[model samples]
Target: MPANTAPIKWAQRSDSLYVTISLPDVKSESITLTDDKLVFTGTSGANEYACDFEFFKGCDAEKSTYKVLPRSVQMFIVKAEEEEEEFWPRLLKDKAKEKNQVKIDWDKYVDEDEEEEAGGFDTSGLEGGQGMGGMPGMGGMGGPGGPGGGMGGMPPGMDMEALMAQMGGMGGMPGMGGEGGMGGMEEMMAKMKGDLENKGGDEGEDSDDDDLPDLEES
Candidate 1:
């Protein structure tokens, strides 16, 4: 049993988890989904790929659907009936032993929909201090042990690119000039060039008197 290279990524949301797999050259007919298992048989380049994964918890199979892309597949797994709206410790349960492999820790999962993050600052004490934004008033401004904290204090778990891609549409990237960052720059340059050309024409008109012949009366 050799190691696998299916390359799957997962992220948790308030109500669901998004799981994306690199499934290039996979036919829609070759994909299968069950209550707690996912199997895909496909080919990429000269190699044949067979990806199979069984979930630790049951999901709403009827609600869970996948979108096939040119090179991969994106799946949305609704929270299981028994699960609550909370952070998932890991994408999948550690079942390496079942597959005759050693168990390895994977990146922890985060809730994508929650804005009240503690920068992953772990704090647990008495009083009304055990909240997301850190101990009571000790939150905000991106500080430690509180919400709005920086990502440094937290363990690296999020697929930042994927998270941002999903968030990019919802939050809309700032300074992107509305869908066209460089296009905005091109528009500005074109306008500047047009203005310069108009200015040149104005200068030529102002100097038209200098080119006038003194033989106007002659």
Candidate 2:
């Protein structure tokens, strides 16, 4: 009698999908998923193997629903090809050699000295009386609080006017007395306090002013 071939068996569960193919020998090679298909490569000893047919194409569809198992099926056997050696390793070696042949430009790297030369910085003006503060808190000369008073004990080399000007111009801060200036906060607080005091003093001031008549000849 001819050797009976069994069909491959497959099963699907909530967490996983499985497929089994049988070879003639009990010790076949491992199976793998390649290009979304299951590939069974037999190892050195296997000539043929057999697995259940229900896993292959055209099994009972109604029996294999989401919750249930399909009808029982017989096994099928497939002949295994002899394993081919040395093919994969040589292919990888050639690919690596091809990749290493690619050239990269070393000239693209920038030198540190060249980068510094390209950056513009001048130190000529940073000399002599050029040092900050001819006096305390008064940079250069003729700073605030008049000559020699030196900004009333403020730090040396500190110039309030230049600092304010630089802050206003470069940092987009408001001018000294503008609406958004620091002066606005002080002026607002002073006005609030004056208004509150005037409310209490209003009646007394009115009475005193009324009691005093305009100057007339007696």
Which one wins on lDDT?
1
User: What lDDT tens digits, residue by residue, belong to model 2 across residues 1-218?
Assistant: 32233333332222122233333333433332221223233322324432111222122221111101122211111111224311111111234432332122122222334544433212122111111112221123333443344544454566987665655555434664466575564466788999989997986567666778799989
- The per-residue C-alpha lDDT of model 1 at residue 20 equals 61
Model 1 lDDT tens row, 1-218 = 44255667666555565666665765623556666776766666566656677766666655555545667665655667663556655555555623442122234344344425713312222112112111221221223433333353332355666555555556545575556554554467799999999999988778666878786664
Residue 211 error, candidate 2, Å: 99
- By how many angstroms RMSD does model 1 differ from the true structure? 17.6
Best by TM-score: 1
Give the local distance difference test score of model 2: 0.32
Residue 179 miss distance in model 1 (angstroms): 52
Which lDDT value does model 1 have at 209? 67
Number of residue pairs clashing in candidate 1, backbone atoms closer than 3 angstroms, sequence gap of 3 or more or interchain: 4
Candidate 1: the clashing residue pairs are 133-146, 133-147, 134-146, 142-148
